[model samples]
Target: MTVVTPVAARVTEGRSLTWRVSLSEAADADMSTMFVVVPATAPGLSTKDVPARWPRDTAGAKPDPERPLSKVDGLYLFVDVPAGRTSADVTLPTLGDRVAEPAEPVRFRQTDMDTGEPLPDGLVLSGSVLDAS
Candidate 1:
């Protein structure tokens, strides 16, 4: 199973939010991609904005540059996970000056990089809420 949690309970304006992605076990060859979906109505949030930092490997060697997070369709962020890794940290940029406090929680999904098919038991709901000040 895959789980995502916010690194901080509250964030400030113009600052990025960090999320920790944890897998119950190491990823297999088929499970290579993970997607984090945020609400589209989030204030001051845009998919075009680049993440403040690169994803950091938490349970292995340095993060794979080829596996950096990329925004998709202006709604979700996806990253390629190295096989045998259990956890990683991803930082997303929050632009503009307006406060962003979405009512809905963030969601997570894992899929095969090549086939683009979701893995069994890959969809997780309500991972965390983004609370920006």
Candidate 2:
């Protein structure tokens, strides 16, 4: 899994901001699941943390993105689904629903749903506005 990018900013003032974050397979083929993580080489990698579940609707926001951890907005990790495959499934390794923004570097990893093999390239760590509530 990849971290995409570490967010650096103070918590929003006044009202809280809602952030809709997504971490999915960025490859052309369908991936069973994706991971958001700080690379082992990254300074503050936490093996106990779990990535946030990505929303399926890639075109628009279905559920509002705002949440308590919305401060770490603009960071996304993704992969594309392969042909003949149209579904994504992932097993969360920890209890945390969303990973906290790391104080150091990180990356997202796409893996097979069954085999757990790393998906081919096309992964990225980008700072793009996803959607907001």
Candidate 3:
């Protein structure tokens, strides 16, 4: 059961947010990769905005513009985790200027790379609310 907790419950627009990923237990040998999902409706957010430390998985990282909004619920940002690490830090890219005040809380959850399913225990207890100044 892995859990991802945002360092801050809220962040100013145009700023980056950091999240802490804690493994309930030591990372499994087969658990080599993970991903975070952000709402597609998030303004100016994209897979290309992810930090370099967490390289995007070319295979599934690309979002289809033609996909229906109903079907496209969120965007995927992939990350590689070294084995046995108990925890890791993920810093999201800066919010774009287009972000509006009182923007929706940016929720995040860790998911399985292959399954594209949220980890059994990787639900986001709280999302980082965006404040436009």
Candidate models: Cα lDDT each: 0.45, 0.31, 0.51
The clash count of every prediction, one per candidate, is 0, 25, 0
Q: Which stretches of candidate 3 lie over 4 Å from their true place?
A: 25-30, 36-74, 96-100, 119-121
Q: Where does the lowest 10-residue lDDT sum fall in candidate 1?
A: 59-68
The digit string of per-residue lDDT tens for model 1 on 1-133 reads 6776777424443455566777798888534455544332333233222233323322122223322122332233465456888877665554433445553223445555465554566643233234444
For model 2, give the 10-residue run with minimal summed lDDT: 9-18
| Candidate 2 structure quality by residue, lDDT tens digits, 51-129 | 3343222222222344222223222233434545443332222122243343322344444545444457634331211
Better of 2 and 3 by TM-score: 3
lDDT of 1 at 37: 45
TM-scores, all candidates, are 0.46, 0.28, 0.56
Candidate 1 Cα errors over 4 Å, as ranges: 34-74, 96-133
